[model samples]
Target: MSSLISTPIAPTSHTLLKPNRNTLLRGDSLLPKRLSCTRTRSSSTTRALLSTTKESVLKDFHERRALKIISGLQNLNKENVASVVTAADKGGATHVDIACDPDLVKLATSLTSLPVCVSSVDPAAFSAAVEAGALMVEIGNYDSFYEMGIVFSPEQILNLTKETKRILPSMTLSVTVPHTLSLPDQIKLAEQLEQEGVDIIQTEGGKGSSPSKPGVLGLIEKATPTLAAAYAISRAVKIPVMCSSGLSAVTAPMAITAGASGVGVGSAVNKLNDGVAMIAEVRSIADSLSLSTGRHIVSEKNTLRL
Candidate 1:
């Protein structure tokens, strides 16, 4: 890696963060009045940007404790999508990750002031979502593809990043490093992604993992793959690493401890049957991420200029 792109974070030892009380609140409770984006479709694209000054997604990634709630890339039901988006913002999530569909992006934007991110493996899918008010775009979670025995090669991942950038160069781009790759290869891919102009790198596990232990130990065992990848890859790339998949409130702090700037949770929130349950789960993850990440935060913010 060139010196300009060699800025990687060194993982540090950090204690597990204690869980906070689960205080569920209505979506309206966060503000005296609800916040809505009144901009028309044409103007929304102008306001939705990859970065902002004070509370930009970039700043949150720099802070290293941001929590992202995933509503599934395949989930398209209007009611279910709305419920998940409401729960994510009300539960204190830094952002909500949803399917890269124009309709879903519009629905998410109509509901909250929090940054709305859309995800997909196809680069063509992002254009409509961006026009619909999506502020962030992500490629490849790959967790859903495991059941179909589909795996992405490093070359495919790099191409996806390139194509997505070609479509929306200014959009905050996040690409997931397939957990299927060896740790060293994962790191190499991350470094290349930085060179490709991806703003963030996300790591995933759980679909391909089967935990042998039970209870709390089982949860840790389940999260081990992604957490380990985050430790290795975050140390090899200048961009912020978002540790995701198979993570719960119990292991979220472990991700930040491993040098990830944030955690992306999917099934933990989306799998819940009710909106209230989803809100509670989101809060729990936020609680786990309350640890002091002072050292890693300082290192990343200074080394990263993208």
Candidate 2:
């Protein structure tokens, strides 16, 4: 009887109160608006930085004397990579190409302000490297693979280019036309790549050449295939053409004269065991390009005067 003192306690109001629509709307309007503004500013800043970087990276190419020093796509030796980067920086190179690794990009950026380009055949691998500060990504430099008897077909290269563009639509992309193909096929591939929005086409033929002689004549013989590819593909496409492989101080300027907007030198500079020699090689190539560009400008001016 004592426990039944159920004087009907007024039914406790157990109903949970819901937030008012107006109150919820006001709450959402506050912090979210500030976050949106912040995101917009950050996006705008990133775009501006990218534009400036691209402009600076392409400055020398537009001037038709871009000297890109490559350290090899498979060369991961940090010490060698560092030496190559240092040589390129000190040798007045406009760009540097290294393997597609975020750490390598960081290392190169730390060593020099030159636009660092990462090389990879895997399209997916470029994202992290680009995020790490690589201003350009290349899809060729297949010499090491060629040594292993591996080669990329035209369809394979096209698909890779498509995928890369999908992933990094705004990035500067350079694709190489495989030297295994006939020269006509190379020009065809170059035209196809240009149609796919490729910013540059790089020609390679060093792995295919076995010079039969020595000295300057041998150098010319070594560079003939790539120079031919450059001359043909440059005429077939509207974008910049980078003539690479088996080139030296003797033939780098010849590449520019063959309608290449730029020249990429690798073994000539990277093969040297001495860093001083590496730097000297890069300087020689750079000087050769400068002299070639100067002569071209003078020739144009004289033509105008005439």
Per lDDT, the best of the predicted structures is 2
Candidate 1 matches the true fold with a TM-score of 0.78
| CA lDDT, candidate 1, residue 225 | 95
RMSD of 2: 17.1
How well does each candidate superpose onto the true structure, as a TM-score?
0.78, 0.82
Question: Model 2: residues >4 Å from true position, as ranges?
Answer: 1-45, 291-306
In model 2, the worst 10-residue window by lDDT is 1-10
What lDDT score is found at residue 206 in candidate 2?
80
Please report how far candidate 2 places residue 240 from its true position, in Å. 0.6
lDDT of 2 by residue, 1-306 (tens): 111111122221211223345643444355477776776788699889877877788877877889899999999998999999999999878899999999999999999998999998877778889879999999999898777667787888888898788777778899999889999999999999999999899998987898999999899999999999999999999888999999999999899999999999999989899999999898889888784456568899999999
Tens digit of per-residue lDDT, candidate 1, span 53-109:
223867789878678899888889888889889988878788899998998898999
